[model samples]
Each structure stands twice: as C-alpha cells, then as structure tokens.
Target chain A: MNLWRLPRLRAGALAVWRRNILVWRKLFVPALLMNFGEPVLYLLGLGFGLGHFVGDMSGMPYLAFLASGIIASSAMTTASFEGMYSVFTRMVPQKTYEAILATPLEVDDILAGEMLWCATKSLFSGIAILAVATLLGVVAGWQALWVLPVVFLIGLCFAGPAMIMSSLASNYDFFNYYFVLVITPMFILCGVFYPISTLPAVAQGAVQLLPLTHAVMLTRSLVAGAELTQPVLHITVLAVYAAISYYIAVILVRRKLLV
Target chain B: MWFPPDWPGLSHSNFNRHAITFYNAGSMDTVENEVMAADAPTIRARGLCKQFADRKAVDGIDFDVYPGKCFGFVGPNGAGKTTTLRMAMGLTPLSGGTLTVFGQSIADHASAVRRRVGIVPQADNLDPDFSVEENLYIYASFFALPRAQVEARIDALLAFMSLGDRRRAKTTTLSGGMQRRLTIARALINAPELIVLDEPTTGLDPQARHVIWGRLNELKSRGKTLLLTTHYMEEAERLCDELIIMDHGRILAQGPPRELIERHVEPEVIEVRGEEGAALQELVASSGCRQERMDTSLYCYSRDAAPLIESLKGLHGLKFVHRPTGLEDVFLRLTGRELRDQ
Candidate 1:
C-alpha cells in the first residue's frame, strides 16, 4: 500500500545505476545509434514520405505533428526495450542480480536501479529525437525543453509495466507477446501517426484508456506549441500508471528473485 | 578490513543498514581484529528451515561459523546444502527458526549483516559486460567502499587470485579457472570477514581445483572466516578445519574430518578388486575385518592392515591397495553410496 516506502532507494542502488552507465558508455556508439537512428528514420521517412500525401491535419504540418508524437513514443519504445530484454537478461541468464544480491544491495535496490536506468535510457532516446526535431524547425521555443522531463516521466511510466513483463517472462521469446499485443497496438492506435480525433467514437474512447495516448498528447502539445486540452488529466494518468506499475514491478521482481 | 578481508530474507526496510559504520571508526582494522579474536560467531543458525512448493529443502538445521576459521558443508547434490546457504545469506526466506549474523538476526538486519559478508555462488554469475577489473570495481561499488581504497584493494585481490595480468580481459573470455578466481576476488572486494563459497571448484580440472584450493588455503591462513559447500571430500579434508556431512536436509554428522573418520570408520582400509576378488572374499572374511562388497570389489576395514596385506602377498591376478581410512569412508558410511539426485 505504501509505494513510497517500497523502493530501498539507497546508495546501493546508485552503484547498480553507475554500473549500467559504465557499460552503456563503453558501448556508447551502438547504444546511441540503435535508440537514436531508428526514430530519426521514422521521423524523416514517414514524416516526409507519408506526410507529403497526408498534408496538414488539424492545421499543423504533418511532419511537425509526427515529430512530437515520435518523441513520446520513442521514450516508450526505448524504455520498453531496456525494461524487458535487459532486465530479464540481468535477472536470469547473466545472474547479475544474483551477484549484486550477494552484496549489500537488497532486491528493492536492484529493481529501483533498473527502473531508473530504463528511465535514463528513455531520456536518451527522447532527447535525441527532440534535438533532431528542433533542428528541423518543428520544435517550438524553450517550452519544448519541458518534454525532457515528461519524457523521463513517460520512461518511468512505461518502464514499470515493461519490467512487470520482464519479471513474468521465462524466456526472451515471452517478450514477443508484449511487443505484439501490448506495445505495437498502442503505437498504432495512440496517435503517433495521426490524430486520434479521426478514430471512431468508441475506438477513440478505448485509445484514451491507454497510457501512450496521454504521453503522445502531452509531448505533441509541448513540442508543437499547441493548446492543451486537460493537461492535468494527461499528467495524472501517466503518474498513476507509473506508480501502480512500479509497485507491482517491485513485487514481481521480489517473487521472481529474492523470495 | 572490518569485514578480515575474507569472508537474507528479511524485509529490507524494517532494519536500517549501516554500510559505512566501520569507516567512521579511525582504527577499522584493529576493531576487526578484536572481533576476530572474540568467540562470537559471525554466523549462527538455529532450527533454520526452508520448504519449497514440493519439498522441504532445509529441515530444521543448526550451525555456527566462527571468525578466522574455515568451515565446510559436504553433501550430495540434493542434500539441501545450497538451500541452507541461501537462507544464511537471506536470499531465501526461512520457513522456520532464527539465523543471526554479526550477532544480529538476519530476518531483521540482513543488510547490516551482509555488509560484512561476501559470497561465491555455485553458478558463475560474473558480469560478462565488464572486464575482470571493472567487474571487481562494480562489485566494490555495491558496498559503497571508497573508490581510492577499492582501486588499491582490487589490485591486491587480482594479484592474490593470480589475475594481475588479465585485469582488462572480458569475463566471457576468461577460462573457467580464471573466472572462478575473479568471482572469488569479487567476493573479497569489500574485505568481508565471512566468505561463503558454494561449490567453488565443482567443474574445474585437477590443476584448476588445486589452484583454487591453494587460494582458499591462503585466505584461511590470512584469518578470513570461510564457509563452503563442496562435493570434493579431499578438498574438505585438506581445507576445512571443521565440517558437516549433510543428507536429506539433515546433518548426518559434524566434526573435524579426522575425528569423523576416527569415529565412524576403521583406521585402515584394504581395497581389493579383480576377477579373483570373489575367491579372496572368504580369505578377507576369514581375516575377520569388517568389509563392504560392490559388483567385483571387496573393501575391508580394520584397525590394522597387517593381516589384510599378509593374506594378499603371494597372490596373482588380484589387484589390491592398502591405505588409511579417510573422510570419504566416514562420509560413505553415514550417507550411503546410492546416487542422491539420480
């Protein structure tokens, strides 16, 4: 019930966090390229090739519209990759968590470190796309920088559920169901490619229930300098998703490893 | 050195873990030395038990590990040694009973207790992503050891494990012996007083096992407290100052290896085998020595080997060996020769 007390959040977790950064830095070029390159291709390829025919939607250029949407989705995708594959690999096959568990670190510290690392990776992705879009002139004034923090939130938000998947997974193949059933559907229906208002009324309401839609809405408004519609509602939804799933994720990891 | 440079699942939040308590003390090594001299147990378990969904993994076991000594648990594959060790580490929650380390119940103060302990798990869990030295540094960071001190300690540990030349080699690239040594070095990174090794040399060749045994002996000589589980009877006899032979989730016998040998087995053994062993069985029985029989061999035990050897002298086509009874005799006497897991 007390989610705040759930995470150990100790200096031990920082060691785990620092360890991840050290490894990431060692493989910086490939790690950065994988997270950054795909999104830019999505932004340029779909933004121009697809945007040319689509023209403007809701009085905005299609390329600009897609850029902000991609920012939020990038956070979701990158964090999901980390939370699912990396977390599972560390927890199971590599037995890295077992090694750390032998140290002063508790299970709470390991999972907290993992979620935070996932968030950090999410930021890396969102920021790269944000920078690219800013250079392309789609991004607005300094207000667009606010997406950095939101992207972080989205990263943490998405990482929680993705970690739950990782905890539940028995093998790497188990992640395919998550990507296919959960992530891909959200990517398509969450308005990254087009506005959700175009959907049928019943389908529009269904997409609103998904966390990615709220993420897309927040990033689009901030990056495109657009008017907000119930921004508090969007932020609240992301926060709730983050908090509940994070709590569940910690429990799941405990059951999977420590217990 | 608060933790001799050698050497659960309580909910983490209930007890505050003091990671840097020793560093605050000006003379940390002196305090550690004092603790080592004291008789207080670094690890104590009473009525400790663990029940899995389908099995009672550990059934009401009691044990103690003292500082500046090496202790051992020798058992078959399914004898619950690993489960008991895991419970001692607080990696698994106990089904019953109390376990205390550093005189504090692990159920309440695991982190505080764990800060002074190091472990080499049965499976190789080295982080393949990092090189040997980087892996050591990362493990050190978990204990929050000062970076400068850890840098110095890592060098010493690498040298101690004979890994000075391979500091930057990726862990995946290391041979099994080298990786096991690195795992041992990682365990010592925090300079823990209590080092728990689970099957430290299970898969190693004879040369590799000897290298490990030598390193373990050096750790013991350096006054680090060690608790380990091994299938190697010779390793147990050579290294363990005190040991427990366990089976079916219970300790069948516990004592110094030599004492266990003396208590349960004859001082001498004559192992006879060949096509002629059956013909020699009556001769062995006639000698009045206690004996056991396998498919084609007869193992005779006696307080003296004179009669057993005297009968075999001019015999042809009979292979025989005479040796002193060892821990293996006591172990097989108590636990039986049936395959535990199979």
Candidate 2:
C-alpha cells in the first residue's frame, strides 16, 4: 500500500560493508583462486579446443573473441552468487542482518551495504580474469584496461536482481531454479561462448534484452581495442538495469527485514 | 528524536539540537550519576498493539519505564513480551497507538531513538565468522564510533564481561554462556542510555545466570535504565524496581514486585503433596483460608500458618512446607495456571 515510500542512502551502510570486508579478508585466498581458476579452465578448454575448427570470427581469433565475453560474464556470475548465496546465509542462517538492525543502522543501510559489497566482490573476480587473459595473449592493447570499470558496472547490474531474489528466498534450494532458469540461459545466449548473431533472428533479438548481452558487447569492444559505434547506448543499457534493479531490490529488502 | 551527540555523521546543527533537547528532557546525565530527584520515564507506551493477520501479538498495553529503574515483563511463551520489546526498540512497527523513547515517538523517529539505545536480543546472534574482539569492533561501527574510541573500550569491556582470555577466539568457539556474555558486552559498546534485554538469562546454568545477574545489577547501580523480559519470577523479584505480569497480549497487573504479591495473594503459602492432600484440605475447609489445586499438589494460602499447621497435625501422611508468598503466587493468581503455548 505504501509503494511510494522513498529510500535514502545513509552513512551506516559503510558499517555493513566493513563487516563483510573483515570476514572476506580471512577467506580471500580460496575465493580468489576459484574466481581466477574457473575462467582459466574455461578459456583453455573452450577457446583453444573449440577454436581449432571455428578459426576466426569477424576478423579476430576465436580465443581473443571469447576472452572479452568471459571477463564480462565472470563478473556477472561472481556478483550474482555473492548476492544470492552469501547474502542469504548472512540474512537467514547467520542472522547478521538481525544483529545489525538492532543498532543505529536502518533497513536501507543494510540493503545498500550488501549491494555495494557484492559489486566490490564482482570487481575482484573480473580483475583476476582480465589479468589471466592478458598473460595468455588473449587481450589486445592497453585499451583493455577500460574493461575493468565496465566489468564493475556489470557486477552491480547482476547483483541487484540476485539481491531481489535473496529477499524473496525462503531457503537455499530456491536458488537452484534461478541458476537453471535465468543464469544458464543468459550464459549460453548472451554471446559468451559464440556470437549471438549466428542464432535465429528472434533468439538474437531476445538476447539483446538480457543484461549480459550489453555487458558482453561493451567488454568485447574495449578488450579488442575496436572503435565501437554507439558506445553510449551500450553503457546506458547496463546502467539502466543497475539503477532500476537496485531500486526494486531496496524495496524488497525493506519489506523482508522490517516487519 | 534524539541521536547521541557524540555519534559520528550527524550534521553539526542536528547534534546541537539533540544536545539541547535532551538536556531539557533530563536524559543527558542518564548513566553518570544517581538520579536523586524524580526523573522522567525513559520509555512510555500507550495503547500499543501489534497485529499479525487476525491475531493480536501485543494487544493494547500501557507501561512506563523511568530512568535509573529496572522494569521487568514476566509472561509465558506467546504472551507478547518479545513483540512489545521489538516495538520499543524500533525493530518492528507499531500496529496502533503511540510508543515513545526518550519522549520522542518511535514511529516518527525510530532511527534517531535507535541511535541512543542498546539491545540484547533473546537469541545469541553474534557474528560467528568474527573473533570476540572483531564482533565488538563491528558492532561499534554501527554507532559510527571512531576506531580509536572503540579500541579504548574493547579491553575494558572484555575484561568486565570475563571474556578477556577469549578475545581472540572465534564467536562460534565460545560456549553458550560465554556467547551470551559477549552479546551483553556488545550491547554496552555504545554506552547507551536505555538498554533493552529480551530474556537475558533464559538458557544459562545457575552459575552463569547468577554471574549475568550480578553484572546487570552492577549496570543498574551505575544509573543505566534497564528494561528486560524474563520468565523467571525470581529474577523479576530480585532485579526489577517495577514489573508487569502480562498474558494473552494484555497487562494483568503492574506495580513493584513485592507490592503486587502483597496485593494479590495471601502472606503465606503451604504446599501439600501426595494422596493425603484432599483429606487435609477437608480439615482446613472451616479454617477461613483459601486453597487451589494443581495436578498433584494443593496450595493453601493464609494470613497465619501456625493455626493451619496445627489443624493439619492429625493428617500425618501428607508432606507440607510453608513459606512466604512470592511474585510467582501473584503471577499465577493473575494469569491463571494454564499452559500458554500454541
């Protein structure tokens, strides 16, 4: 009934962010290894093994084309997982949100802090993937560094939806549906492994509606040092998803935490 | 609305307004010295209620908690004690009526009121991933206390709670009692004016319970206002300056513990057990005393027990013990002896 209740950003958010950082600092080693290790295996297994036959796509080697897409997609997966699994654990099993709410921090503070933390985590994973791809000669010129900030924005975009899911989740089992129905479809159809242009016209049109498609397209242009046309349009699409999802996520989290 | 003047991030003018208002409201010296004169109530609720669907979790209830006094809410499970506490702490919204903390409405100024209060929840929801010190540090950050200021109190608080040796251990590694103590310690990190505790010693052993009670008494003696809920009648009698007995989301009686017992039940009680109770009860039927029967025991209440004991001499097979009536007798008399559970 009170859908027009406006949400404001406050200072207590940093406290929640600091709490997560303190805990994450203790477990960063294994976390970093997974973030870096997974993309490396995918790049080797799919890019090299599958690229032998595909050769080149649109005047670039298949491995190079695939590497940029992985950078964008990896950030998506990392942020989504952090927002869903980790946020759920903190909210439900651990009761971290309950403890924080007892203090001066409001529901809005916890929501903003959680989203920022997930985005920060996504940035970490994306950077590691980029470094590995560069060492393997899949990256183009220094212009590829521009992909870092774009990867962070992709993380924020996915984190918003994943957090909305966390707010509605009753148990961990519900997350499997999200992965199978939402994440898997995007991973396959958003041009991560191959160009979506090869799919049917209807499928390609549907792919453009997905947030991952814009992330992949923008990252590919930046990583390949290609002069991109309508670059603002691509960035705006990702930014719009991030902003709208963030607004909805905040509303959902407020309802869940403040009864 | 009253945010603590020292908490970080408040605008300079807002801090000045809070300081001047609270000074006029007489909450500025909340914990520093004994309040010799009459003080204003730290919390007030008038017709406060909370509804979930068709059920009333906390039906219209009223109470006042004065500064430097300990107020206790004693009730059985599902009696709306926790719901009322949650509302007072701004963890949940009020369904109807007015509730205020430090003279400011909770519904209108929850965030500001929350900044000036502390809470120890019934459950030990400490961060299991952090060490004891880290738990304290993270909680202090919620109040926006400077790292240096929080650091200054860490050692003192840990030692005061007898958690000094376990400061470096993960919270999950601590025993149940230790974790509860740590939770209490965490609540005091902000030096709050009003501390709300929900069943602070519900599951502790006798020794641990006494230790926590001793610490709570110390906090009270230092002039900190305390509002707590407990199922233990003895705890309410020993610690509360004033207490309320609640049932079915309503207040049954409200007054000092001793006064309530004195006003509700007789001065003395004789509990008789075994099959001979009915026989003994018949003999005292003409003694002008009152009796109530439980499943296996008969409780006799009288102003004088000497004549009652004399009347029971011939009924030699029954076991009986006489003692002064306590808050438990008053509570049972007010709320009835029925089990209150879903």
lDDT of each: 0.85, 0.85
- Per-residue alpha-carbon lDDT of model 1 for B135-231, expressed as tens digits? 9988988999899999999989999999999999999999999999999999999898899999999999999899999999998888899999998
Best model per DockQ: 2
Predicted candidate 1 versus true structure: per-residue lDDT over A41-105, tens digit per residue: 98889998998899997678988899989998889998899999999989998999999999879
> Residue by residue across B129-195, what tens digits does model 2's lDDT show?
9999999999999999988989988988999999999989999899889999999999999988899
Q: Model 1 compared with the native: what TM-score?
A: 0.91
User: On residues A154-213, what C-alpha lDDT tens digit does candidate 2 reach at each position?
Assistant: 988898899889988999989999999999999989998888889999998998899999
Q: Candidate 1, fnat value?
A: 0.85
The ten-residue window of minimal lDDT in model 1 chain B covers B8-17
